[model samples]
Target: MTRDEFMGRLRRGLVGLPTRTAAEIAADYGQHFDDGAADGRTEAEVAEALGDPDRLARELRAEAGARRWDQEQNPAAAAGAIFGLIGLGAIDILILLPIVFPVFGAVIAMLMTGVGVFIAGGFALVVGPFFGGPGGVLAAILFGIGLMGLGLFMIGLMALLTKWLIDATVWYARLHYRVLKPALEPSNNRSQD
Candidate 1:
């Protein structure tokens, strides 16, 4: 491609960047074309030597992202960034699932047990009164019902808390890729060099 075509494509790919920043990048590439031409190379040769416009845009974005990553001091973001990089492929899944699930599974099991107890307590409250055959079992049944209600309330609270935690975990995982993107791009630069 000619210099104009290459610069146009680069500008398009970098639309998300600030106008001045994108213009600067385009100008730098334009200079590369000029320098190459002065050395008796065609525009296509300079563009090809520089690499694909799309990849360059991604790298630039990633670099910006990484810089932001440095500025933000979030522990969860750090963990997500690590996992995000690792979890791109199958090995991360293999490593993460085993590490993650055991704790989650155990917590779920204990929560379910609490719910089961509340249900059983409710059933007892319903049945114990009838089986007593019209004695002062009314008081006992009322007490049992109170206990069951309390249990039900606890379960609801637990459910809400668990949902919030799960939501946080999911959010962290999703942020992983964007955080890692900048870090990953620089490695490509090193390799290409």
Candidate 2:
């Protein structure tokens, strides 16, 4: 392909990627082409020497993916690995009674958690005015009870939501890993088979 056609294709393939990354790649290839042309090569010949657009894009993608994996795999790092995320999901479900009645509990937990958060927010809003009511002592008593229930509900709601999120992410990551592991680990292909 001509340089212009290759650049257009590359740009399309890199859609949604950061502009800086695309610009750097374009600049590098442009420089190489310029250098080669100066040494008595045609644009077509230069592109041919440079290699296939699809192959180059794939190489860059693999490099970027590798860097991402390395960053994630490093222990004592803030960013968690896919496996760690999976385990977190497992723990969230186990702690929040996710195993008892997966479908029913998840739905109920979501509803209850929403109610709890709403009630807690309501407490914050009414706490000030509640102190000035005619039956201030009685108001305070009721407010205290409401606050306690709100706190418990919020805690339970967050636990339930967290469990759902983790489980979904774990399942997604596992499926993705299954598809990618073979292509990525050629040495283990025979064993996997």
Question: Which candidate has the top score in lDDT?
Answer: 1
- Model 1 worst lDDT window (10 residues): 78-87
Clashing pairs in 1: none
Off by over 4 Å in 1: 1-90, 133-135, 186-193
TM-score result, candidate 1: 0.44
Q: Which candidate comes out best when scored by TM-score?
A: 1
- Superposed by TM-score, candidate 1 places the C-alpha of residue 6 at a distance from the truth, in angstroms, of 20
- The sequence of per-residue lDDT tens digits that candidate 1 reaches over residues 135-159 is 4688658766877877777677666
Question: For model 2, how does the per-residue alpha-carbon lDDT over 43-113 read when each residue is reduced to its tens digit?
Answer: 88778766667556554543443344445433222123333433323444455454536854565676676
What TM-score, computed on C-alpha atoms, does each candidate reach? 0.44, 0.38
Which regions of candidate 2 deviate over 4 angstroms?
72-193
